[model samples]
Target: MDLLPSAHVDAYPREHLPPRDQWPVLSCDLPSLAYPDRLNCGAELLAGGAPDAPCLRMPGGEVWSYDDLRAAADRIAHVLVDDLGVVPGNRVLLRGPTTPWLVACWFAVMKAGAVAVTVLAAHRAQELATICGIAAVGHALCDIRSVDDLAKAEVPGLRIATYGGEASDDLLRSAAAKPDRFEAVATSADDVALIAFTSGTTGRPKGCMHFHRDVLAIADTFSAHVLRPRADDVFAGSPPLGFTFGLGGLVVFPLRAGASTLLLEQAGPEQLARAVAAHRVSVLFTAPTAYRSMLQLPGGHDLSSLRRCVSAGENLPAATWRAWHEATGLRIINGIGATEMLHIFISAADDAIRPGTTGVAVPGYEARVVDPLTITELPDGEPGLLAVRGPTGCRYLADDRQRDYVRDGWNLTGDTYVREPDGYFRYVARADDMIISAGYNIAGPEVEEALLRHPDVREAAVIGVPDESRGQVVRAFVVLRDGLPQDGRTGTAEALRAFVKEEIAGYKCPREIRFLPGLPRTPTGKLQRFRLRDLE
Candidate 1:
């Protein structure tokens, strides 16, 4: 197994320590060789060497090796380029969860030298229409489940291909007769590989353009330093292929290490644990929330094969980390990754973790805490906005919001954090969305964490609202367990509110609480605080 050592200096053992000086600088200008440059890194690794190695495992229980993956991609590349007449740099839309077909289509689009426009697999017809309209996509390859939704959108010139089995029954027969082997298409480093949708909490999602170099940057840096993979390891995760976090976790990292990845149809906790045992998945990349629920499963599932479990999408709480570690011996790797930055900025190794902190910055990136309003750097242990600058910088798709997000080469994620003296970062909250009432600054996450501790509360969201008395008191919107009664005595919404008061502080106690069927979440399972605020 490849030992990807700690990027965290203080956390690193004396034997595994990286050079103190000249270490923070990134190794830019990645290898350039091949247009539609293959967007998914898994197949690109096959072209680089390791041809026959296993690469993808679908939920239906089929394994496709790297040679198989590349062959499949090339065959489709021929169809997409020759039969469909797709041009280099043209946008070819791709949608669905992590299935072998989704993985194949992603690379096939890139191998054809077209930009892979990825949309959330969970997106409905209206969402698909809006994205296709914005990107002017003329072609799409989606799963059978999402094909109906994509078809519902009356996108002119839009051609769609289904990926439940074959492109169609006729194509399946032809592919079976023909011997499968294909050469990769040459793509330029500067050529666009992917246009991923950013989770627009407030409004419409924006397409973030990333280059082939940007796609490989994570493999060279974070993957090399953090998730050092082995040939025997099998990768799997929940984030849909549309999100960069999922793309990197399920495809890029393992392929860079010449390993296999589990491309599941469903990655919910139960399915994920089952996939782990079935495929012998060793490395997991998912959210902290999912890990917490996995612990609640009857007795604990066999995760013994798992060597690493990465948590992202939101801050990984220490409490959640403790619960997961106690249930399964596997330590959860925590990090903070945004769509724009390409991959994780800060991450911790299983052995070198401080539960609450988001590890140290990756070798290629420089991170610091800054005043949200002033944009000035803050001292260690002081709470401020987290600012980062690195090789993989934020490049939006001609959006005016770029000016607000990127200033002086620093990409400002609207998140609050504190830099520990030892270089780890502790997440505070989202900068703008924090709740403040009666001269007290309260992070919504703090209260939500306290609420999730209640057994009856399945989910909770905290938001500040206009109040006549307290001037924007903390209000919590909660979702009770399905079996639990909605009645006041049984569901315990009021009791949970009181519990939060005791767990946190009297001032931070939710002034009002309401029970709902479920909390509104993004396709990635991130709580939509903007929508929650609207409910108030």
Candidate 2:
């Protein structure tokens, strides 16, 4: 792959991108993915729609119109260049919840031709320092409430600016005095726009670099084709802006469609439900766990306004999908995506969705099940590694693991799946999450689905634990519905075990069941099975 003439003055992110030969095969076959050489995604997204139209909304009834958001972003971009001495391609770490101001900073970075490194507001000092160090971040734009931990990170020479505060030096306060009009940098379409770090479920977090065009590519392919957002639709979800899932669903998709989205700072299942009904959210994006949890709420929510529901971050169990449809009469669009790929590559909406299987590759992408070692395409119905290539694919920043993720021009997503005869891909388990117990190959998610079918089970996580006789045995951690009996631990465990045995093969049933208040999950609602394995 030949390099594009970079517009970056700093040149750090581009220099750190994986070697060209190590990059995954990137395809831009879709007509919509053809972007101009000098592109600024921040400016592109904001360029759509009438200036007076609503763009971002908050739970408190505060709405920022397209004009309002652009003015704020333009002023912030001026502050970054004039006051902070920032140049194009400087990595600016953004730490905050999902807020209009936080989003403004993201666009500000884009307009200034700087790279954005967005981390979860819940991250501690160590995690923050690791990310800053890995990306060689020099400046940070943080929310006042979450600035303390970032300050404690103690990255040397890391200049920090606080937003949403009363301080005179606050980002918003400084921006107020600056002119609300500035020219967006004419960056190359291939210019690095953001570095999204993985959730670190397996081990050390890897920074996945995405180009400016990649940001719009996801919206063009998945959101345009599958989600099919309308300008009148109000989008809302549980994921924060730090996660690509949220960034695409809440920010990129809606903006590309000239729609509005409600940004929630703390969106749990109950809160998400209330927000949806209160704000009349039509498009929803969240994980399967949240969908299942919302179903078990004591006083049911009025979700009649919902027109589309998307589930990702983890596999969607067939039982949960059926239950949601039965309760809401809406088919949940289930998909599988990776931080490396930036957003979903496989998904189907409306009548095209097949229960339990992740739909075919989105229009601009190609997917196949392949042998992990040899990279040979496997026959349909056989479980193998998932290989994908599309308008967006993995491009790790200065990491040796890039070779491990992209092999033979294909990105092996480290997920095990089976391609049905109809071409739909069914998730088996994560490559590392597969359990071999007593010579039987078992998938943890399969067991989890069977357990979720039980009436009392609110949430479940299955993992293989070491056992002297069987080499490894299935262990399940369950969270029961509220008001369920907690006194008879033995009786309840036995009954749940019996239920699972009835649902799945007796050999695949969990031999050990432990009840818990809740399962360990990332901020994005992905079950941290590695943490559960550590408990054993």
Best by lDDT: 2
lDDT of 2 by residue, 1-536 (tens): 57689999999999998988888888898899989889999999998667999999999999999999999999999999999999999999999988999999999999999999999988899999999999999999999999999999999999999998998898998999999998999999999999999976567889999999999999999999998999999999999999999999999999999999999998999999999989999999999999999998888989999999999999999999999999999999998888999999999999999998999999899999999989999999999999999989999988899999999999999999999999999999999989999999999999999998898888999999988999899998999888986443888999988998898899999888888888999998998887887885
What is the Cα-based TM-score of model 2?
0.99
Give per-residue CA lDDT, model 1, range 142-241, as digits (tens): 7667778889988889987666654454322333444355444455554556777776656788766666767878777788777777878888988888
* Candidate 1 TM-score over all chains jointly: 0.87
All candidates' TM-scores?
0.87, 0.99
Query: lDDT, candidate 1, residue 71?
Result: 77
Off by over 4 Å in 1: 1-43, 165-183, 453-458, 479-487, 490-499, 516-518, 534-536
| Residue runs of model 2 more than 4 Å from their true location after superposition | none
lDDT of 1 at 180: 58
Worst 10 residues of 2 by lDDT: 484-493
Error of 1 at 176 (Å): 5.9
